[model samples]
Target chain A: MNAQQLCDRYAAGETEFVAAPLGGFNLAGADLIGINLTRADLHSASLMFAYLSRAKLAKANLSGAKLSGANLNQALLTGANLHNADLHGASLQGADLRSANITLATLLDANLIEADLRGTNLSGANLTGACLRGANLREEKRTYSSSLTGAILCNVDLQGANLKGADLPRANMSGANLREVNFRNADLSEANLSGADLSGAFLSEANLSGVNFAGALLTGAKMERVLMTEADLTKADLAGALLIDARMAKTQLAAANLTGVRLNRADLSRANLKNANLTEAEMIETYCARTDMTGVNLTNANLVRAELSTAILTWVEWRGATMPDGSEYRD
Target chain B: MSVQTSLGAIAQTFAQHNNALRLRKLIFCACTQRWESDRTRLEQQPWPQLLQDLYYRYPNPEALGDAIFGVVKQLNRQGEYSRLAQIILDQLTPLYGENATETTQFLTEQTQFFNEETQFFAPTAPHLDPDDPDTTTIITIAANLNAMEQNLRMRKLLWCLRHNSWENDPQALLRIDLATLIGDLQQEYPTREDFKQALGQVVGNLSRRREYEAIAASILEIINPLYHAMFSPDPNLGDALPPVVMVMEQTPAATTIQSLETEVHLQTAISPPDLSEFPALDFLKSDNPTTTEYDLKTSTNFTPAQPPPALQSPAVKLPDYDRYGVRLAVMKYANPLRAKILAFSILNHNFTTDSHEWSSLRTQPFDDLLRLLHEEYSTWDHLVEKLTATAAQLEAPAESTQAAEAIAKAMKPYYIPSR
Candidate 1:
């Protein structure tokens, strides 16, 4: 059916177009609200600027479709195949995309706010500069965690997004605005978060091994028990961040600002803290075996009961610093 | 532009597009879509010269071969093909072959006739001679049906009507008057079907006078060629789709696009293994998830219809056509089969379940259907209804048939008979 015919029929209250062969169709700027096109062959179709809000397209073949600037808000796209689809700048706010195969689709600068994306396959998809604030990527019972492996999330504004236990290993999230993003128990290992602002982000118990946080703003971030082995925090601002019991073996913390940061009982073995400002940082009972603390400023910092014996402390400022011996450093 | 200028343009374009591969598509297109006489004309010419003529005639190989064939058809119908071909052959003898020239000289004597010839074709193709600012082109008023089609919303304004975009648009109109059924056509435009009907009515009325019949034919040529391919005894038509009045069977210009894969050299293409020239019906079938009524599972119980009387009798059948000719003609019907199926479904609504003689026609593989249509149901109007209804559906509310219709339209002159 043509767009106009479909619209006319919709006006007459007939809406189901299940499995329609509408491939290569141009429905640009059309208003197709609430249409049920389940299992429709929409490959290579152009729905650019089309209003498909609340549309039920579950299991639709949307591969290679051009849906740029389309408003798919609250649309049900469960089990839909959107591989290789270009949804650049499209909005899927509050949409239910559970279990959809969206692999390699380009969602560049798209608005996916509060969308239910549980169990979606987003591997290699470009979500660059997208806003997924309040979006759900949590692993629910009977539904696998949404896989975002190899996703390009560069400069994305994911503030307040719920990514609890989502598989996001190796995702590129450089320069992203991840403030208050819930990463509880999520896998973010080897992910790029360089220059990202993660202030007040609740990242407790997240797997952050091999992650790059160079020049990132992690002030007030909750990283309790995070597996941060081999992570790069070079020149990062982690002031007042909670890193209690975090695994920091071989982590690069060179020239990073950790003022008033808590590293209580955290592993710092073989970690490089060269030239890092650790002023007033609480490092009580922290493991510091063979750690490079060269030129590090530990002024007024608490290192009580910390293991610092084999640490490289050359040129480290220790003025008013509490030592492992329960006495203050006089220099 | 002069003949030399046109030739220079051709030569320049040829230099840029000298793949020799591009010509294979052009030649294949020409060989496929051309009328019998046109095909014969192409066959008579040497390959290099034919390549040059085709390039100079159309230029864009990527375009539909139908358009290329359309130009030749128009020229041939005007009886101008023989005249033009003889002159081109005589004058361009020195330009190609073993004794060829690098630079071509101006055909000064033929330039006048060429410029005059360019004027008649101005409405047909306004896209030529664009770079020549020094030349003054002849202007003619033509009915641009395309522009009129776009503004289908305007009540009677069948006129994209000088309201703009008319110059670039092809708009030379032959005003056919049915004594004033004209109905203020500029205010309330009729559907294209209606317009065609009115034109046919006007032309039919005027055909009584022998002198005006030529004008009548010219006006109707826009709606012509619907039955031309079927009835025009194109070379060795044989028993392959005998002349039926309304049957929209294979046309001479019906070439399958396996156009150029380098993989489809005639050696493999001619292998009579039902190679399924036009495949991929997965997208064409209406996969209505709500209804499993059209599934192929029901195809098993269907008893095949008895073979047609003509096929059984073998009365007055002509000599055998070469494999390529048979394949080309057979390939035409199968390609349009997609359009036919979609159009058929829309018309026959319960086409899958209906217990007609042609029951389960849609369920069969494209190859089987082609064989059935070729060997048995060749003369049935039920088969012919594919084209007619496909044409009619173009005017209907369902426009998903547009792509299929367009592909079919390009290969054939669209005519939905008055019924």
Candidate 2:
């Protein structure tokens, strides 16, 4: 069936288009709300700015389709093939795309608020500036289930997205824009997020143990109570960030910028902070036991009551910084 | 004294205890509600000191239980019972065995009762047929589900009130009417889909609101029924059965469910992941890299990006005997062939004669050996650059990243690090 026929049929109250061969149909700007197009062949179809809200496209073949700015709010796209589709600025809020094939799709600046993406394949997808607040990218129920496993989300933008409880282990999200993203309790262990821009992100209590944030921009990020044990934050920018009570045991923050950062009561035991900038940073009562802070700039930093026993502070610049004692480092 | 009056006196005593001069000023470090400011101090207190503090607050065991129960109730309003339970259990641990105080025993009994009752219903709906002749059973089940759902919703709302980032208005709590909420939930959830959709909304709201602890707690609620059914030694374990069973006799559904419980136990025995069974979120938050890595490696239920499992393919390898013993028998179609093939390809890529690749193929039913070969080669090629960099790091000086990379590379299946 052609796009025009489908539209006419849709207007005539026939919503079922199951297994319909409508490949290459120009459904651009079509108003097809609440339509059921399950298993439809819509490969290479033009659906730009179409109003397909609440539509059921389960298992539909929309590979290489043009769906830019389409309104797919609350749409059901479970197991759908949306590979290589152009979905720029599309609204997919609360859409069920569980186990959907969204690889290599262009979803730039899309609004996917609270979408169900469990086990969905978003590998190689360009989601620059997409809003995925409350999206479920969790693994399927049962042990070792298919999740966002092997998904390549390199350079994707996920700024301001709420990824609470998201399971993104092993997903490549390097160089992604994650500013102000809420990743509370998200499982990002072993995930490759190297060079990701996470400025102003809220990552409290997130499991980031094995995350590779090497050279990532984390300026002003609030990572309070985060477990970053052995995490490689080498050369990462954490200036003005809050790491209050964060556990960073043996973490590598070498050459990282931590200017004016708060580490009050934080555990940084045996952490490698060599050459890190701690200018005006607060470390009051912080645990720095046996930490290697060689060549670290501690100018005007507070270390009041902080445990620095057996710490390797060789060549550390402690000018005007507060010592573990009540006295100043300079004094 | 009344419970309220006694609670006030106890609160005042607790305040005095807080005011005792330690000369050390504590800092509030953790952000948001997830932080427990007194965690360090409370955890460090000796048993005698803890008991003295408790004695100062309440004279008798009943009073102590009452005080603790009051706090538990308050926490329960927000579904924050788990943390409170942990704190209470910690405080009462020294009282266990012959040294057990009357207060501790009462608290323990109350806690166990609370746990059993609260963990009554799992998130998954019980099997109930609407078409059953016994409408009474269906009605009872529906009523119980409604009550449970209402309780969950109320807790969620209370949590929302506490976690609301916007203007904190105390009036929000006043707006909730328990009766009205129960009435609303009682309005027929005839279909499981409707129930699931509603539950999804509740969880989605919790997630969006950044109520992560609540989300984790709710996940626990889902697993609680199964956990108790499989593990709890209580003979009266079935006392908390679905309301349907109370009204109706044991049927095929009940029998099948029992068998399913057994199956769950068998699966748990087969895999150690099941042993760490607090909830799925507990596993997620666990610091054990091996556990998380193992979990990541095994997850293969919905590989949407890849082509349908070559299980159906005429050329795919089908083992004459299942490798995982009882696990294979349980999961039925779970194929480890691909993971094995990928591992083999990675270790040994070069073969002088094509016979090595073909002979390794064994009973594999695929004529498209080239397709398999291409997939494995590309994965290896893609990983080579990263692996080489890691290898370089290993030579320079052993760093955490290099070690992590080596471990990740080892655990990674062929499908991951997708190109």
Candidate 3:
């Protein structure tokens, strides 16, 4: 069916149009609320500014569809093929996009709050500056799922998004807003998170090995038992972050801010800490054997019993800090 | 009986209804207490005063006959003679004689197509016929479906039957026509529990056909609105026409309908529609464990092979699927198709064009080859452009605009006009 016939039938209160062959039809700016176009061939359809809230387009072929500025809040797009679709500035809040093929879709500035995106293949998709608070991008266990692996998520707002156990390896998430995001048990190894804001994020037991956190903000982040081996954190901020029992051996921290960071029992052996800030940091019994601490600031830091004697400590500012020998440093 | 109570009771029986003002106006035009010149003036007076003027002023047989005849004439002109005919007859028989043949004859003669045998309009008669409507009425209604489809109430009834999917037991369905079904509804299930039990029987183990399952889902969708309207304890929506509710009110099941809402509310009480609120249709929602990805039903199934995990946090709030038909349809179709497409893609991963499995994937009836092609091509626009170029090469002379006009156009210096 073409756009006109669909609209005419919709106006006549006949909403059931499942599996319709409406490919290449330009249905831009149509009010098709509650429309049941399940499994429809809507590929390459121009649905710009269409009000399709609560629409049932499950498994619909929307590949390459132009859906810019459309309202798809609470839409069921489960298992849908949205490959290469342009959904720039669309509102997909609370939409169920679980297991859908959204690879390479352009979703810049999309609002996907509380949306279910489990097991979706979002490889090469652009979600720049999109708000995905409370959205679920967790991995599906029973399938060959790689949720957002290699996705471009620059400057995207992912606050409160549950990406637990997600496979986001090699994903480009630089400059993204990841406040309070759940990355627990997630595999983000070798991912570029440069200049990203990760304040209050949960990364407990996450595989952040070889991750690039250069100039990234990790303030108040929870990294308990996290694996950041060989990861770069040059000039990255980690103020007030909790990294208890974290395995950060060989990780870089050059010129990185670590003020008020809690590092209790953390494994920082052979890790670089050159010119890094450690003011007011709680480093109780943290392992720092053979680690570099040159030009590091340790002012007012609680480093009581921290195993850092074997580490290079040249030019380290230890003023007003509680040393590993139970003695307070006095400039 | 008091006139107001009698009116209210009669109003309850109206499958189709009108205001007291129209009834009063018909009585006014029919009443003979006022003369031909006095009708225009008498109609201006209030109904309370007119009621006194109509009954108290006119006690003679000639005046009563004139009033009844006038009302019948006006009602006949308005095409409402059949609806109010029984009311007039009931009122007249008590005041006049038992065998009021003159009024009956006059009433019958005034309206040509009254067809009092099917007294659907009679307030005293049962709202639903004890059997299905005659074949002629059904056929006539079927013939002019478009015209009759304007009546949503009628259409919903027809839709219920169409979506019920009687193919499993065609004989059973054939024997149970619409009217007969409604009539049987009066006697078959005395309580709403029985109705629900029958629905469970129908929904749980009905049929194996995919079409039937789809139809069942739609029927369930239709039932939501139908249920609320039919079993609503109070007519709170103020809907002008409520034929189903009216029919239910006259049946024994109506008494049990008072608690049906509470029962439904309990089932849907827990979570909002994370994906959908069609929990009752769980059979359709759940992925069949026995089926492989190739066996998955919906062509829309782009589902990952992975089983769904629990929500990481309780902060995620979702809208209910029962909020609208679109949500319901989404939820209904979301069931049972989560793991197949990935399996299909994996099976076709080797991409051996000459292989039997690869050929099967292309020829499989349920498989979406276009989508697979779309995924490979990246975008349909690119595919179309490539096809158009190929077509250009094939039909170069017949279809190419470039060959027709652009060949002679001048090539200006700064004008690469690819635009």
Q: What are the lDDT figures for the candidates, one per model?
A: 0.56, 0.53, 0.56
DockQ of 3: 0.01
Q: What is the interface RMSD of each candidate, in Å?
A: 28.8, 18.7, 29.9
**Model 2 local distance difference test score:** 0.53
CAPRI category for model 2 = incorrect
lDDT of 2 by residue, A1-331 (tens): 6678889998999988889998999988799999999999999999876888899999999999988657788999999999999876577878999888888887764666678877677766766445565566644454423245445665454556556656666678786667787777667777787878799988888888878988788999989999899899987889999999999998999878898999999999999998788989999999998999987888889999999987898877788999889689764
- Which regions of candidate 3 deviate over 4 angstroms? A139-146, A327-331, B1-419
Q: What DockQ does model 2 achieve?
A: 0.02
Q: How would you encode candidate 3's per-residue C-alpha lDDT over A217-326 as one tens digit per residue?
A: 89999999999999999878798888999999999988677888999899999999987888888999999999999878888889889998799998777779998888
Writing each residue's lDDT as its tens digit, candidate 3 over B1-419 gives: 44444334444443134544444545555564322211223335655454444444333222443455555553212234423533433343223221222233322221222243232221212243223233222222222221121122223323333344323221222222232233344345443334433432333321222223223222222222223334543332222222221101111111112223223121211221122222111122223212111111111111211211221132334322111122112212221011111223322442221246533532321113222332333222333343334324332223232311211121111111211
Each candidate's DockQ: 0.00, 0.02, 0.01
TM-score for chain A, candidates 1 onward in order: 0.95, 0.74, 0.92
Q: Which prediction has more favorable TM-score, 1 or 2?
A: 1
Error of 3 at B406 (Å): 47
Span of 10 residues, lowest total lDDT, candidate 3 chain A: A138-147
